[model samples]
Target: MNIRVNGEKIELSSTVKVIEDLLVFFELQERLVIVEQNREIVTKEEYQSTKLGDGDEIELVHFVGGG
Candidate 1:
């Protein structure tokens, strides 16, 4: 399926059906990341239930520690 992530279009395998799977695919499953799908902010608890589809727009914002 094709989707737009952070303004970039990319194709994903069929195995990636939900937000959780997407995170794991990107290797960001363990990080503190905020996911916004199609202009709506998705809560962490909803990750597993949230489904992704073709042409969907996703914005991923992950935090970094420094100082």
Candidate 2:
């Protein structure tokens, strides 16, 4: 499936069906990340259950620590 992530278009394997899977695919599952799908903010608890589809727009923001 094709989805736009952070303004970039990305093609994901069929195995990636939910937000959790997408995060794992990108190796960001363990990071402090916020996900927005199709203009709506998705809570952490909804990641596992939030389904993704073709042409969906997703914005992922992850915090970086530096000092």
**Model 2 worst lDDT run, 10 consecutive residues:** 25-34
Task: Give candidate 2's error at residue 30 in angstroms.
Answer: 0.7
For 4-44, candidate 2 gives per-residue lDDT tens digits of 99999999999999999999999999999999999999999
Candidate 1, residue 29: how far the Cα is off, in Å = 0.5
Per-prediction TM-score to the true structure, in the order listed:
0.96, 0.97
RMSD of candidate 2 to the true fold?
0.5
Candidate number with greatest TM-score = 2
lDDT of 1 by residue, 13-65 (tens): 99999999999999999999999999999999999999999999999999989
lDDT of 2 at 50: 99
Measured with C-alpha atoms, the lDDT of residue 9 in candidate 2 is 95
Clashes of each: 0, 0
